[model samples]
Target: MAYQDEITHMDRAELEALQLERLKKAVVYCYEKIPFYKENFDAVGFDPYALETFEDLRRAPFTTKQDMRDAYPYDLFALPKSEVKEIHMSSGTTGVATVSGYTENDLKVWGDCFARGIGYAGGDENDIVHVCYGYGLFTGGLGAHYGGLNAGAMTIPMSAGNTKRQIKVLQSMGSSIICCTPSYAMYIADTAIEMGLDPKKDFHLKAGIHGAEAWSNQFRANLEEKLDYKALDVYGLTEVMGPGVAIECMEQTGLHVAEDHFWIEILDPETHEPVPDGEWGELVITTLTKEATPVIRYRTKDITRIIPGECACGRTHRRIDRLHGRTDDMMIIRGVNVFPRQIENVCTGFEEIADWYQIELTRENSLDVATLKIEINPDFPMDEIRKIEDLQRRLEQALKDELATKIKVKVVEPYTITRSEGKAVRIVDLRSEEEK
Candidate 1:
């Protein structure tokens, strides 16, 4: 059931040697072809040829999202436009979009990585993969589609939206595998119930591949219970070839990085220095085998630490713990820092609430105020206003205890919160608009 056993199960020493060789070549490629990398290397007084040991990589400057935007569409591409076969861009919610280009060979590498991930999640050619991730500009749909095809499975490009039809397909089409954002999967489960279809008994799904957003273990338990399948987390971004950068095997211990293709490092966000294994820090990646656009020392801003030991699945590639939170996504409210995932953990811990919630921050009298709007389960005692009020009071108290700050907790009826077919919008800060 293993894909590319030679590379996946290679000895740790051999893998490191391979990574070092590829790292050197990537450095030389970027320096020679991309003006941005060339200037960066010059500024750092680094010689691409002198990068003998892995430690030497630290000399190169870090690549940021702003750097990608500054490079614009094609300035950072290593290969000519004729050689680039595919293009994708980031969501661009925060600022200008970061573009990524891929050659045919790069596409093959991406497919291989995803195939490996599919295998890790117990997929085979006999399974039907229902990809609900949005198609086109977003990488999730096509990434999952290509991987399913590469693994010899029939991929159903359902895309996103049209929830009722999605449920019908699950009942009639004989699909066994599902891929989408975690929030969307939960939404699907909820919608199916509204349609009078039992998610556990009516659907043919056996496993699900969920990512593109941070989710808590409590959410995972809820998802598994509702969907009647094992929910596996996959990690990737459009900037680094999407959805197959790392994935959870059946063991579910940690996400196994595709080290043969990507060289990963955990670095302190402030010091920009390498952190010890199992310590939380930003994830930095170097593309070893990418052709069209190879990025060196790309800081992901995702907070996670490397797991020290080999996975029980026997993959030599190191594992990364589930993301804690992104440095940029952390919110400062009334001088107290809070992460949306922290609120999610506390909300999902309760059984009376649905798996949907939104965090809103606003300015009142020059002070920041946080409000959490949660969706109550439809089956909960909605007829009793006093019970609902009591639950709201309990939620507010629980959030205060966890966040160490008073927060407004408002509970709404089922399906009140806006659901995302792609990445969920959990936080909405109104301070900027109010100030302006």
Candidate 2:
């Protein structure tokens, strides 16, 4: 597919050529404006401009989550605080928040990236977008808000929660597109059905942009079927910016990163070295053009590949596959590494289960116990409780067989789990005995 804009639509050679010039500028900007970068570069006896090409990125020290935490508020910004018009931040689950300031021009670039993403997912000027992410501190809400307006669409800044209100606005305004977590969309579909509304017939939705949580392909397919919309994957983190870092197009093959805005590299987790394009590795990004916070080789920990081949949709920008798992989120149970997606994949295989499930990790008998509580549809026959029990037994066996570990399964009433508006917390670990 042809790219949406001239600057973003450039061919690989042209894009890379443009990036080199921007990279040089970014390096100089960082050295001049960011105290942390200036001292680091000076101590290393390295001149940021002397090193050229993407490969030279390795020469710079890799940035980590801790760096952002240490920097706290404006330590990493490449411009004066007076020039910044807005500030965005990480959730600060670990106590210290990583805040990034943005100048007026920076906000324009952010809007442009998100607008490009909207178009990639088949948005047009006439579309009405309902942004269902958090508004303040978090990046998703405002990012989508600006992008929708930038695309010349009627924007609805419906910042999450109050499902009834959200549905009312969606119906009253005739929203054409929605941006939220995939699970939230499913929850909305269920609520609409409960309210005697046919989701497929009542809404004007043509497409949905879903992200902020790791999900399986089966989940995506199911969401498309239930919501009657083309669901696309969006990828990003607060450290990098927000949801518009990269996005999947109508091709639905993989997410195309904005090469002109950020440089991406995949590295082996163990060695912290660059891996081949197809190999699974931790994602590292360099802000070739970021002015507020320019990060060099910042490790993202999310696992995926960068597919360099041209997309059928015709965009020349590199595409990164949907995240499989993250290094920090990987759970180690009895020496076997487990991912939430693996559990999700296993749970969705059961036809009777409602696809909403959570895994609880607790300690008992001096061993780690994994309990999978899943919701089942109400239509399940009361007389066939034994049969359903047998099915649960089989499911438990299947999970152990597939995951190479034993796990307990619990069947619960429908709609038992909490719905997430932002990123869902699916795993709860209580291995206190083991830790002690």
Candidate 3:
């Protein structure tokens, strides 16, 4: 691993010691430099000065995403603009953009974090790194680009779109490490086949680091089989320095948290209290080393849990399970909470359906309606109308078994649904303003 052994191989005691040491300084700095933190802490009667251990740190008030969005462009920044070297932000598809700034050192830390992630995914100097995530304000492309360069690999800044050109580069350049959103990777695999190129034989892809959207284990397995490469899951958000928070190693069990830079706690979603080590809960993170726009106990709203056992790859920094879904991603259907990931799990189980899918939501006659839209596998015998109808029936039944609610399933022709260059849209809510 590139520049990784020092922290990656640290034992539990050593890693926790580093986390404790940094946690103290991070809280004090946030309280002193960011007035928002100061006011939040003061309002809860939580004194940063009294912080001594993990227990005390938990006493600190939770920092929600709304807190950061409410802060807006630069209000959450801990330093003056003169010191901020770069700025990046979320796409704000859910709401207003949450701004994040970085100092020179912060950028270096970001590079190091992603370099370690790249190494975990088996990226090396001998491999050509192809980064396909969108660039500029979004952190996916640039962060992976930094990590590729930092790892001393020949990095290609593809920055999404132009599928034919992307395939040309993949074949001609012999790129070995591909970084992009999971949905884009799936699209690329489909496109390669449509272009009559065997994904396993034509391209030189050895591994992929896919993130930026939630995908099920079924999706990853199907993707790996299609591309004949290791599909590693890398997790992050713009607020937490992007694409570098947790990275799945070749072992494929779970993602190792960057414990030296982050302190994570899994708390129950409804109660907001720490759960047992192996229980599912919301992931709350504290930026232990970030300088420019640090957040303490930021509620990620991501649903995951700590894996109980040790990873086979020997990375001692604790692993968290791949996210099932975000709390914000949940929707109520027929008195049951339905998540996009649950739909994905059910849809991907069938070989007749393509990986691409979407859910259409609307309100009709004072009742909510949700429809699952999936594309048929192009190679499947679509001329068999009976088979198509049978597939749809099975899908509806499987969905009801999984979601405990009947979700209308409609199978469309191949390539009917839009392909994504970045994070794929899972839900298309067409509810009227009055209905909402």
The number of the candidate with the highest TM-score is 3
The RMSD (Cα, Å) of candidate 3 is 1.3
Instruction: Summing lDDT over every window of 10 consecutive residues in candidate 2, give the lowest-scoring window.
Output: 1-10
For candidate 2, give the lDDT of residue 211.
87
Q: Which candidate is the best by lDDT?
A: 3
Winner on TM-score between 2 and 3 is 3
Q: What is the C-alpha lDDT profile of model 3 across 1-436, one tens digit per residue?
A: 4557678989899889889999999999999999998998999999999898998987799888888899999999999999999999987877999989999998988888888888897777887999999999999999999889888899999999998899999989999999999999998998898899998999889899999998888888888998899999999998889988999999999998999999999999999889998899999999999999999999999999999988998889899999989898798887789989889888877989987889999887787788999999888988899999999999999999988997988899998899889989999999988897
Candidate 2 residues lying further than 4 Å off, grouped into runs, are: 1-3, 42-46, 433-436
lDDT of 1 by residue, 52-85 (tens): 9999999888888899998888999998899999
Report the candidate with higher TM-score, 1 versus 3.
3
Candidate 1 wrongly placed segments (more than 4 Å):
434-436
Sort order, lDDT high to low? 3, 1, 2
Which residue ranges in model 3 land beyond 4 Å of their true spot?
none
lDDT scores of the candidates, listed in order: 0.89, 0.83, 0.90
Q: What pairs collide in candidate 3?
A: none
lDDT of 1 at 301: 91
In terms of TM-score, which candidate is stronger, 1 or 2?
1
> What is the C-alpha local distance difference test score of candidate 1?
0.89
Q: Give lDDT: candidate 2, residue 396.
A: 95
